[model samples]
Target chain A: MKLDLQTELCRRLNITYPVIQAGMAGGPTTAEMVAGVSNAGGLGKLGAAYMVPDAIRDTVRAIRRLTDRPFGVNLFTVDMTDDLSRVREVQRMLDPLREELGIAHGKEDLRTPNWFAEQFQVLLEEEVPVISTAFGVLPDDAMREAKAAGRTVMTMVTTVEEAKLAEEKGADVLVAQGSDAGGHRGTFDITKHPYGANIGTFSLVPQIVDNVRVPVVAAGGVMDGRGLVAALALGAQGVQLGTRFLTSAESGAHPAYKKALLESTEEDTVITKAFSGRPARGIRNAFIDHVENSGVAPLPFPSQNTATGDIRKEAAAQNDPRYLSLWAGQATRLLTDGDRAEEIVKEIIAQAQELLK
Target chain B: MKLDLQTELCRRLNITYPVIQAGMAGGPTTAEMVAGVSNAGGLGKLGAAYMVPDAIRDTVRAIRRLTDRPFGVNLFTVDMTDDLSRVREVQRMLDPLREELGIAHGKEDLRTPNWFAEQFQVLLEEEVPVISTAFGVLPDDAMREAKAAGRTVMTMVTTVEEAKLAEEKGADVLVAQGSDAGGHRGTFDITKHPYGANIGTFSLVPQIVDNVRVPVVAAGGVMDGRGLVAALALGAQGVQLGTRFLTSAESGAHPAYKKALLESTEEDTVITKAFSGRPARGIRNAFIDHVENSGVAPLPFPSQNTATGDIRKEAAAQNDPRYLSLWAGQATRLLTDGDRAEEIVKEIIAQAQELLK
Candidate 1:
């Protein structure tokens, strides 16, 4: 028997299934991946946080070229400004890593772009079907414009307070991202939670459900049909998969990074701010070890991310995973090699239907 | 109207329901709470890790007097011995908390008892129907003795390797504890995980379930029927709750501790080793702040636990929540003020039945 697993959020997003391929930043999320998920009935998304406006527009156009199904674009809404008085100290912290990776950097060079505003403008101009923002929600005018353009807005929140905040900001859907999630945690404020928000999905999904009226999609550690059904049982309307798509056929992840995810265990991942100033869960390697063992804290988001970009790029070019930031969740063991997004989505739905039966 | 949710493990436990009141150490679990859960068709347990042998026997008798249903007694399987070479430094580190709590400590006076042997003997002598061990499993001889005496042996494991180890060591049931659980995490060996076992429930349960052959009981962050149903959907045969029972009518927790839990948010609690020299999840207090800010690594398990014993007792005696170890899970906000174990169990089962229907 086919289960009626489509939730109200599915209707709102105009998707046949209540599964979301999370808008993971940088590599991993590709136009092909997003289009494939959308074609397979689940919502596909482009992780466009670090992308330039031009790239965002290109990806949106490319996804449109592949599928007419509804898809989404994710952006980072947090400001990039920071007090760089301690920039030299943080740069010094990454000196050893840079030397080992053969990246030339003598000055305090980092990218602090006015990208968020430009990115928001591009998202609106692209007339995207779904706009998902991480870290925080879009501003009022931009948000109103997106709503005015008849686009669905999704916000990632780690706590009930953030959920309430996102709902108050007129978000159409709340993605309750758990600590088990791969990549950067979407904690709204870092001053209050310097340790990073570590709420598990099992506790987080229901609490967010009880506190907010907006439909929720459970993110983090959701790789299979069991997670899908479990999220449904916890009252989440859908499951947002991040690492699940990392090894998919359409993922743009580095070969070494994808191999690391495929070989890792549940306990192999750690949440650290070594790569980015903000806390993110990823496979532990030499880079994380050096920063953590030395007791030198990374500069706040974008700063640390900027400082480490060259080394990560060099490491990827050399296919050395030890120096690369292999962003992955705790459920890496549940992942397989090179399954297409259609197979991934269909397997989850089929497994869920079997379990529901 | 009812769900036939009973699994093979439930039958082996001689219970009609699949809920197991976690054998929480120290205070939360009581005879009445155990009896209430057992009477209501779930397994209840006594947290007798800190109690003497006579106390364990007395509590078993007390629980038996209250209900004829099956009950369990819990004991610590981990050794109390640690390299006390740094015990003095740890004692020195805790001087401020001791002074503030009005504890009179002159020298290295800490309790190191041979309790495991005595406790296990008492459980076997009293013929406990179910025996649950934490930290590690019982010794081979004790396992043989417990099995020969017809007792169901359950072991708490935080990782997949530990789950397989526990099963190999004759664990009839495995309590797959997530990092979201309150109190001390039951990592088999802390040498590998100096940061404590932190696999989230959503990721931990299914991974452990897929690896082990024995019946698995999902532990940590399970507060209500939603959690129960979710655990079931995740492939766990049963659910074990710790903090869910802390605010129960029959709970032996201090009034101030209960009040602190009632007033706390999910983010308010943190996992710190300041209290017990072992990583435990609890509502953050001033004592934790002092230890954390001072950057003092706690002495190993029993040493740190012993060093801070007087301060915790005095804090409890004085009804000060600030100085006490307010052990709780991440689902603190979901808890009510005062509900009996029976109500807690019935409501969870009822809600689960509704969801299943």
Candidate 2:
């Protein structure tokens, strides 16, 4: 009944059952979950999305304190139009929201911080074994550095076209993100594509595997072993998941947030851009209801994200469910409370093994 | 560029090209679409779900007049619970709406007519080639008689457990329904086993294929040839789609309905029990919004179905938009108006052929 997912995934990743905890930047992913899963024979990921260089260093050190197992740090190698006019347009859109949130309009410092450089440096300094990215493929320099350090480089892609692009960009593995995947779609061109043909893992994985020579890491609504087995059957070398691990005891999600996920039905989740200015699947609640009803055009990418940052932080501090960004996959309802990550992983593998024959 | 989907699907179905048109019991699935697809070398289905025995007979005969090709008729084989108490309970939930709609009371005679008997008798008289059922499997006597008469039998299942059950009950073929499948889920016990996990075609097809000796047909969200190719990769013998053909010029879908489906995004389609008592995916519109926002408890199955039958009829008659049941799958957005059924069949096959390598 043992599925040997580590062995299968390791062999595919050139690692052990093709299991990797997805790098969720905002929450659910924690040092403990990463360390524990990695220690138990699957890869764990550190979400260094919001981390500054120093924080990334400290977090890597923190994870190193617990286990010697290999873990990864996820980055956002976004390629925005370097046109300053576009950046200013985004800045102008945020001015009103800043005033509404009780902040002054003119702070003289209009420039955004260079968080990407510091974070990447920290990963290099820590000699992390793996590095993953979203939005776009990692820069050539980063790929070169990661390769020099003998680290695995993974990239998330929503379509096979994107998969080929990532492979061309020197990605070691392709994380084929299905439409059912929670969090932001790691599409290379959202503007031209406009999110058509939301191929699920079952549809997307095989196509990516067939199109690209690189090993495919399936991501999206994979909650258990049955899903993992299906991914493998579809030609994925490994499976990466987020929501399934979010409700585990080691996850950093709020108690209310985790409880809401466990109690949700499949109907309760919807894909919305209300929270992070990016399309993500989560449990539908008051905030989503407002977004659906309000019809407010969300600003582009990091700007809308930055503008909502204060609101999200305040909502979390106040334990206000309406303002919290509940980023989760379609299988949010399947996540159980107080469950050990190891038990969940083992159960998935065992159940899949039961059906394999 | 040319895909011989007909030949391929035919090969897979153990019939001619593997295309199966929906048995849409509503407005969209016309005799023309059915006959056209069938004549073009694919299976056409008559949606006899909402029809009485006489109507079903007429529709079947009408289809036969148009084409000599083998076609199937679909029916609802749901087990009606023998209690009228629930009807009253459901009426109580709709009592307030009755007043708003200017009806004295929300009262309708509870009836589960022997439509199956009537329809089956017609098929027997006409010697139809295939008969499929949704919601649940047919009775043993019916299946036995259908097989005895040399008709192929197919049933829809959402899980591997259901696949095993269908095979046990003399099902000739299994149509694995994923969560992305538009319309009512074909679950035998909806209250007991809520079909939440989207065991998509890629995943469900292989699992069912592995578990049973019977051929498997993949359903739900299959829009293009890529989907067909992916399904075959997962061991499905063929694929059945409804939404893909619903928008074709040959279909009888209302102008508004077809237009709405054409304009929809994947995000615009949602699964809700607000229309029928059961969960079905459709375009998000005013009617869905009203029902979702309404605090009324839905009646179960037939009772709730009857309670809203008047509103749906009136809505369609008035072209009111707020009361019509816009049944469609999650891939509704991909459907373009003026799509030729023959071209669609060809496109799917062509895509699959290219992907096969």
Candidate 3:
């Protein structure tokens, strides 16, 4: 018997499978990966948070060029202002590491550009089917525009309060991002200290489901079929995976970073704000340890993120994962090496379908 | 059609239902509650960690008097030493609250009595069918002794490393406790900072199941049938609940604490080290807020816990929950009021069984 694996989210998103490839920022998720997952019957998402407006359009076009299957775009609603003084202090702290990595360190350009509006504009112009916002809530006008364009809007929330707020703000779906999730936390308030509302996926999902009428998507630390079935049992309409796809052939992660993830255990990952001012779960390396133990607090958001970009780039070029931000979930040990995104999607859905049956 | 709800843990624990009511300390879990659950064909655990050896033996006998079904005893393997100076500081910090509650303030006794050996002795003498250890790993000799006595030994672990260690140490079962769990964390090292391996139930259970050969019991924020099914779907053999049972008729929790739980939301809970020197998840109140924002660090575990004992007592006596610990999981909002432990067990089993079918 072919079990009815289609969830309400599947019907609403016009996808065959109730699975989503997470829109992981800082590489990993690429147009090819997004298209691969979508083509494999799951909803794929383009991690276009770091891209300029033109790049976002290009990526959307690129994904469309590959697959006509519906795909989504993810953006970070980050505050683009930078505190130069704090950035300079962070740079001074990074001076030693920069020299070691053979990177030039001078007056770091700390200005953060306002890219969210432009990115959203690009998303609208491209007639994207889905728009996922993280790090902050999407503005009311933008959300209205997306809906007007016949796009489904989803927002990532770390707490039940955020879920309720997202629902109130007319989010078509809620991505309950657990603390064990890879990459930057999708907390709406960047100014407030994170980890205050670090509810895990199991606890976060059901509560969000209960609070919101919209379909809930469970994220963070989900790796395989068991996790997918568990999320559905917990009342989530679907499961969004990031780390599981980080090793996919279609992922844009550095080879060294993927290698590190393959070699890592749950203990190898730590929630650190040293790489970015915001807390994110990543593989623990010398870079993370040095910054953590350095006693200097990182400047908020974009400033700290921008300051570390060069170091991360250099480390990637050198194939040294030690200095790279190897963003991964606690389920890194469950991830297999060199899997194709399409195969991963098919396997996960097939396995979960078997289990559900 | 009747769904087969039998799991490996159900068979191993000799229970008809794969559910374990949490052994919450400082009230809530009681001998009657434990007996009630056990009588309903699920395993129940007496929270005897705070009790003396005689009290533990008495409680075990008391449960036996109510139900002939097998039950378990829970103990904390805590380090029984305190820094008097730090205790004094904590006591001084609590002075204002004590004064507000019209309680006497004086030199607080900071001595932490060694209770594990006595408690374990009681368990062995009583020939308790199951023994659950938290806070620290069960000593090798005690574990061996338990097995010799034909007592199934289980240890609570918050991380995969700890789960592996527990298996290596011959723990018959592994209780994968997540960060959202109520009361004190079950971390092995009291000296080590808490929340270091703060994996959530959804993320923690599957990984622990993958690492351990023993039956894994998922705990932390699991409240009802959906949570139970979710646990099983995630590869857990059973589910353990804390807050859900806190409102049971058989629970020993103060009426005010129960009321607070009934009125609480997921946002109302916060993980704070104020009540106990160790990190614990509890309902947020004026006391928690005051202590958290007070800038004075709490004394180590038992000492800090002991220092706040009087205040908690007074708060309960006054029917004021604001000053009480009000320990609860993040899923407190999902809890319903005035249910019997047996009914809770039966209802959860029935609901999950229906869902599975």
Candidate 4:
């Protein structure tokens, strides 16, 4: 019953199993969750894109203390130069929701500088073992620095072209993010692929693996051992799980967000640009419906992301699931209640071992 | 080096291999193509949805002459009702394309009665071994007639709810169609899901398998041995392919249409309701671009389907692919040139056997 699921992924990433906890940005991936996954024989990752340098350093140190096992910090190699053309209009649009959530209206400044440099610096200073990115591939110099520091560099891509480009740009691994992935899509060109390339995991993974010399990790809609085995069968060296860990006991997701994820079905999620000018999959709620039905195009990327921040945070604070993003993949029906990250990893490995033969 | 790849699907469908050539409607599924696939030890199905009862009877006789192996005929259990509200506007919109194709501007009738009753009657008279339906499940009486005649009934579904409904309605087998599938999506409720349920094969197949008692056949974006093996890994008893066979030598697809399939990439195809009011996946064409950019809702389902019929047929006659539907899945890069159906089937089995161990 013990199926050896190890592949080039293990040797390359120094992990025991081929499972990688997705760097889910926001708050879903906490230090305890990452450490739990790493200690359970999978690669644990900090969703550090939103965290400041000090917070990221503290979280990495926290994870290190919990376990010396290999862990990663995920950042967004994003273009911070946001287009402000629609910011005032979108901000005005979100004010009503902010008021309803008992948050300030028109009180926050929309323009803010990104901290990617400081965040990258903290990772280098902390000597993080693995660094991954979303939104775009790490720059050439960043790739070189990470490789020099003995850290593996991975980036998520939604299309085969993006995968090849990232590989050419010196990425160590490619994560093929299928349309079924929760949260934001990893498509590189927001202009060319406004809705991201909608390739499914079954179709996207093998094509990406075939084109790139670097190992490919399958992501999106994957929830269990069956998914891991299927990803391997599609020629991926490993599988990256996003929504699966969002409901784990060790996850940092709010109670309402976790409850919504546990109750929703596969049909509930849709790729909407209302929450973040870039499209992300989440359970449809009053906030998304109102924004979409208003027929106003949301401000591009970080602008729209910034516009909705106050309302989302307040919704979480008030335990109102309807106003929260409630990001989850299509496999939400498969989610169970209160399992820790370690237990989930072991269950996946054991189930995958049972299904392999 | 040979591998034993047969599953319960082989026994249930009474075939040597679990590959089911998709019953692509329109002109692709020729009698010769079906015979070639059946002769190669897989099930071949006739795309009889657009064909008349006589044509269906003739195709079955022709397939019987070429190979005594089991073959099936696919029919549409569709609602023939028309919503003509937008027909005139859409017809006017398509007139320019029709004129360019050297066809009359308004020569087609938008209202047409469906031949489901006659089609079902012909299948029973012809004693077809296998019968399948798309768009919707077979009517309860039709299911009874098919089962009573010792024929197996198959239906395609795009969501878990539809799969369970079809099983409860008495479909002997269910083909779980993923969003990556070309041609029309197999979503049962067009009202609730205007865009069709967009779950990927990797997620849809396993979920349907777990929820339904009947065997599930994974469809969409599946192209070769690796797709076949991957579908099996996800617990599907078999796999169905549509776009893969469109380029096969024995297929009845127009030469220009076949050429487009060979040249297009994954990003080239998108789901659009332009060709039909109901959403279907096809390569992006100038016709689709004009319709979508115009901001006019396509006349619902068969009305839009009918209004565009003349333009489509004339484009085919003129050997112009730009105006044709050009249905293709995301795995267009996997397509090759002019292999006969039998050769393709054998190649897939041989390649899959090599990968199984």
Which clashing pairs does model 3 show? none
lDDT of 2 by residue, B129-151 (tens): 88888877778899889989988
For residues A250-357, what per-residue lDDT tens digits would candidate 1 score against the true structure? 999999999999999988888888888888899999999998997777878877787778888899989999989999988888997999988999999988888887
The lDDT of model 4 is 0.87
Could you give candidate 1's per-residue lDDT for residues B31-84 as a string of tens digits? 899999999999999989989899888989999999999989888888888657
Native-contact recovery for every candidate? Answer: 0.66, 0.03, 0.59, 0.48
Model 1: clashing residue pairs?
A: none
lDDT of 3 by residue, A1-357 (tens): 212368889999999998899888777788999999999999999888888889889889999999999999999876777777776778988888879889898356656677888888999999899999887678878877888888999899988888889889889988999877888868887454464357778888888898889999999878888888888878898999999999999889898988888988776677788887888888889999889889999877777888888888898888888899988887787898888999999899877877776
Candidate 3's error at A108, in angstroms?
Answer: 4.4
Model 4: residues >4 Å from true position, as ranges?
Answer: A1-4, B1-4
Please state the interface RMSD for every predicted structure, separated by commas. Answer: 3.6, 9.7, 3.5, 4.1
lDDT of 4 by residue, A185-272 (tens): 7888878778878898888888888899999999987899888877887788899998999989998999999999998887889888
Off by over 4 Å in 1: A1-4, B1-4
Rank all candidate structures by their DockQ, best first, as comma-separated numbers: 1, 3, 4, 2
Name the regions of candidate 3 deviating beyond 4 angstroms: A1-4, A191-193, B1-4, B190-193
**How large an RMSD does model 1 have?**
1.9
Clashes of each: 0, 18, 0, 0
Q: DockQ, per-model, please? A: 0.56, 0.07, 0.51, 0.50
